[model samples]
Target: LAKTTQPISMDSYEGQEVNITCSHNNIATNDYITWYQQFPSQGPRFIIQGYKTKVTNEVASLFIPADRKSSTLSLPRVSLSDTAVYYCLVVRYNQGGKLIFGQGTELSVKP
Candidate 1:
């Protein structure tokens, strides 16, 4: 797994959109970029994944630049409930389908 770097914290008022970016300079060929969202007490929930270009789901949109060295997670119309820690993990297919975790970005949704 490749180590990723992301912002420690971000402040956003309720109903505003928030974008969290991550950088992974040495990602392996087999590694896939995956994003997760974590509220204070609960475990992270899968937000999105991408190998190239863009991928979007109900929760967020992932934008991977041409270099693939960094990516962005875009949260639209965020609200107080959207306040959570965002994690970016470089995951590769592994035995038993297990994946590793990297320190994530903590997003504070203000009211």
Candidate 2:
């Protein structure tokens, strides 16, 4: 399994855009980038997944550069409720229960 690294924390203001980047230098060519977000008292949840280009949802957008060594999770016009810890994971398509979790990035959205 590859290790996904993130910053200890980040800060943003309400209505501001927040971009959190993660690095996966050892990620396999077949691996996919999975972005997860967590609330203050809840388990981390999958936010988005992508191999290249961009994937966007109502809540967030994921950008995977061509090189695939890193990815950025973008939250547009973030609100106070968007404050949470985010994680980026490099995972095999169907290798269940094999992923390892590292310290994630804690994003603080201030009012």
Best by TM-score: 2
Question: lDDT by residue for model 2 over 62-105, one digit each (tens)?
Answer: 99888888899999999999888888888886767355778899
The clash number for model 1 is 0
**By summed lDDT, which 10 consecutive residues of candidate 1 come out lowest?**
94-103
* Clash count per candidate: 0, 0
lDDT of 1 by residue, 1-109 (tens): 6789999999999888888989999887777899888997797788899999999888889999988899999999899898888899888775343566666778888
State the weakest 10-residue window (summed lDDT) of model 2.
93-102
TM-score of 1: 0.92
Candidate maximizing lDDT? 2
Query: Which portions of model 1 show Cα errors greater than 4 Å?
Result: 94-97
Clashing pairs in 2: none
